[model samples]
Target: MIAPDPLYPVLETERLRLLCPAAPDFDAMAAYLAPGTRDFVDLPPDPESAWWSVATTIGHWHLRGYGHFAVVDRRSGEHFGLVGPWFPHGWPEPELSWQLLDGAEGRGIATEAARAVLDWLFLEKGWSSCISMIAPGNARSLALVERLGARSEGMFHHRLTGELRIWRHVARTATGRKLMEGFA
Candidate 1:
């Protein structure tokens, strides 16, 4: 087993392991993101963008004291995607986000991982609320946010990413107790 790094908080769910961004994760990220699989954003998957993006996640941790996690399969240890709190140099508040690679979809992986991240952000981190920015045509993300009970707060015009619908989410307090019990 790879020893956990002290710098990153490792969050685990029933079937997933959320860890800090690492070098090996670049392989999974590059495969999915580089092929333009996630066409919602304006990211150019052509060059070595995945490497830079992962680097940026590490930097976000340094600058903001918090960032998203690389979601991994518990049984296989495959690094598949990202989930959790994120706040870049921007016009608005902190956001909770999730993204999964191709085969990882349709398995409720995003939903399960999202709930865990929400608990961490609100109960553990003492956050009062969180937001998720969803692009207009991204149907998958739209549904997941609705399932999480997030409500629409209208569109946010990102300086570079253009217009994205902002969904508001309230803090998970002791109400989240049942969700936190089985973490391993």
Candidate 2:
């Protein structure tokens, strides 16, 4: 029988370990959910759903060659959450995204994790561009994208999910070019 490919764990940031998600991460995934953390993911909160989420992350490694990562605390080794190149549920292009546990939010961990993942995607993976999808009502995320130098080109239905919202950014700017060029 063919063995499974080994998980490729990425670099750990100041407060987070940006590593590949694994089946053993189900416990960590379960710990990631709180009252409203799933608001932006399109998936509802439930124990079974958490399993499905982790499985889907594992599947991304095989299908897309990359996907969301398991974010754990550097000092305590606690799972902060998942953050990395997410392509939505069924989209073709990958996007940079993050979700921190309730206690881990508001600490710039998402932004830190995303910056590292985005850098790695371009530098290590040779990817040219990346995007993030945010619900119009999600002001915090929108602000984060803006801080990252992503500018909105307007709204459109997510080709894979058909969800409608104002798209935050198409990633056109000197900063965007610098990021992609740094990889070159």
Candidate 3:
């Protein structure tokens, strides 16, 4: 396996800290995998599965040079979510995604964290664009994507997750003057 970026960044928003996933974060993330708490995102339903999920997230960094960051509350220092770029084997496109823990919703945390990650992806990583494959009927995610300025391109049937609406990210200028400018 390839070595991960030793200088992997710690992204900061006004209310959140986006850190690389670590072993200590597994239990917190796993708590969200419990029944009634899990929705939209389909994580397996056991501690071992949670371990593998966290492992896969960390491993994605080694393989792809970039991956999700564990989203933490700046004040409480809680691991509230994961957000960033992801492109696994056979993925339709490189995606910017997010998943927040219970009680973390409706706080604009995902949008803030995602804006930071998108700035890094476009400005530092030099990616031209990315996509968000939002599940149909996920109104919250659809609204978030719209808030990010991503337009709905069309639908795609994910190899694993079945049908999803593919939202294409709005392209930024070479000077990084759009989409995430306010966050930058």
Candidate 4:
């Protein structure tokens, strides 16, 4: 029999743990899919849709070597959100994306998690670049992209979510290149 795939690689920041989506994380992740949190993305209304979401996230890891990570609060051991690389069917390109539960915003969690993932992608995976497709009216995400030093590369019509602004991560400078090499 073929050996089953290994689990997702775990990553950690000073205040968070980036893990693969597991069955236990479903409820917390589903909370993020609830009404107010669902605006930018096309999350369905029914609760069961969360199951499909969790399954799809897990499946993405098997289908692609990289996928979104479940963000956990290291101190509280709470599941807070997801952040990482995502490139589903019909996507314009690979994206560094994030979504946090209602109470988790304003804590710099997304930024910390995203930076770690991006660093890994660039240094370990050797990705030359990536983009974040932010919905036009998502001020919070736009701000986060700006904080990450990504520049707006103009907009595109998403097949599922309509129009979205693509923010390309800044190209590495010589110092940044040296840092990535050191990371490797």
State model 2's lDDT.
Answer: 0.64
What's model 1's lDDT at 89?
76
Best by TM-score: 3
Candidate 3 has which clashing residue pairs, if any?
A: none
lDDT of each: 0.74, 0.64, 0.76, 0.75
State which candidate, 1 or 3, has the greater TM-score. Answer: 3
Q: Which stretches of candidate 1 lie over 4 Å from their true place?
A: 1-6, 22-47, 176-184
RMSD of 2: 5.8
- C-alpha TM-scores of all predictions: 0.78, 0.73, 0.80, 0.78
List the candidate 2 regions with Cα displacement exceeding 4 Å.
1-7, 23-47, 88-92, 159-184
lDDT by residue for model 2 over 1-184, one digit each (tens)? 1113345656667777677775454353555454554753457777677667767877887777788877767797776677877665655356677776667678888888777776666666777677677775778887778777665655656655454343332323335555333332
RMSD, every candidate, angstroms: 5.6, 5.8, 5.4, 5.7
Question: How does residue 79 of candidate 3 score in lDDT?
Answer: 67
Tens digits of lDDT, candidate 4, 1-184: 0112235566788998787674343354554465455542357656676667777887887788788887878798776778989999989888999978667789999999998888778766788788999997888898899998887788889667899989887446547643334222
Candidate 3 Cα deviation (angstroms), residue 7: 3.6
lDDT of 4: 0.75
Off by over 4 Å in 3: 1-6, 22-46, 171-184
